[model samples]
Target: METTPAPSNVDPNRTLLLVDDDDILRERLARALAKRGYAVTTAPSVAAGITAARSNPPRYAVCDLRLADGNGLDVIAAIRDINPDARVVMLTGYGNIATAVAAVKAGAVDYMAKPADADDIDAALQASGDTKPEPPDRPMSADRVRWEHINRIYELCERNVSETARRLNMHRRTLQRILAKHSPR
Candidate 1:
């Protein structure tokens, strides 16, 4: 891992654990967070995350909702068990109300969808009690919102295109085409 000099305003409790299955995302986020002055430890699976937390519980954590080995909720639970004061944020590509609620229940301080910037993650980790973060200057566009909704529904349907299309009242081909395209910014 590359090293970066810590910023002057770095928190005293700057240890952080970042767990995500996506290699590219995990490495990128680790580097970004490191540059932001966090002493970041990266893990690629729930087991690894749990082990890391047990060995050295961090002051903060950012975990992906879905992982190949297990759910990120389990990681949150472990961290909370080891260090109740540790702030945790959950991230997912399949963002939905149910999972968000689950994340909060699992002791996460915040929940964000995937593609969350490093600044946002840092802000969330540093947020104190009862203090809310500022709203985004520009929220998702209508098309992006629609795409996210469709993807959420698709995930709910277990990635069954036919069922998702039926539920959305969209033509199968149209839904397929939409799903094939990349998500809007």
Candidate 2:
């Protein structure tokens, strides 16, 4: 029987490590990436991710910026230590310029906000050196930006609702309501 070759864009070493605390997101992304031809391994925290990387380094990684146990930047550092050429992408619910810069400095090739679909991630993973990926067709709306900013401040305040509210100059009850709701698209 004759067989067709894999696409040139697909890496020969298709090993990928995905580290995210969100169980549903992790599984869904893993399945989608697998369909795209990656051999995926997943972890739920910084420690697990580091252990996995040390045991069997991956050629690509998608790590959450805020893990249950610790920051995902630590995982990126570990992966880079194991294989400097590894392509790591940072995913965060609280997306901001500072965190994105930090992710890049920590060895992540790209930074994506939460709710990133599998297709967008796949494209990012396939991006070659120095080549910028296409911008999102629908950027986050103003409401979404406000939501992200509020969430970022909340995190910075160590998740203290009152402190976040004070910093954002929003009423505590109002901030609480916002926090209770899902992020705006």
Candidate 3:
């Protein structure tokens, strides 16, 4: 607990601390969570997250595994120190079962890929115990992994569908068609 105060609009009881390095994504996520009526305090680096969490503890946290300054696992560690009861969801752009397992072992209640939505994160935070989802322990084929990453990133970008489409260098329709094929029946 440091001296930094919670945002004026935040109710100390139900606030959520969000730690991510990606500025645009972090801000967008904060907005989305705020729309859901949860107070949000954002930190763009590990040190900042730790300081912010210690200063104004929140009921729950969503942290990116990688950050511009350092690893977000450090943020999780600090959160646990400040409030052991705090729920945490670990997020990463490079999704892997090992990282998920490690995050849980290191204090995260759950782990997920970066493109996760605010709702998914909210669900993780709401869990009362270990919330990690153990994806099958097997190496995915390169193509399969790429496809999964693409879809995840697309979902994360939300309105930036065109950016994702451009990155893939295919027309928006092509990307849309591919996503449609993969959608569950």
The worst-scoring run of ten residues by lDDT in candidate 1 lies at 1-10
Q: What is the C-alpha local distance difference test score of each model?
A: 0.87, 0.85, 0.77
lDDT of 2 by residue, 68-152 (tens): 8999999999999999999988999877899999999999989998767787887788899968678877777889877877887
Q: Write the per-residue lDDT of candidate 1 for residues 39-110, one digit (tens) a residue.
A: 888889999999999887899999999998989999999999999999999999878999999999999988
Error of 2 at 22 (Å): 1.6
**Clashing residue pairs, candidate 2?**
none
lDDT of 3 by residue, 29-115 (tens): 888877766778888889989889978887888899978799888889889888998888899988688888889887888887756
Best by TM-score: 1
Error of 2 at 88 (Å): 0.6
TM-score of 2: 0.75
How badly does each model clash, as a count of residue pairs? Answer: 0, 0, 1
Higher-ranked by TM-score: 1 or 2: 1
Best lDDT among the predictions, by candidate number: 1
Model 1: how far is 108 from its true place, Å? 0.6
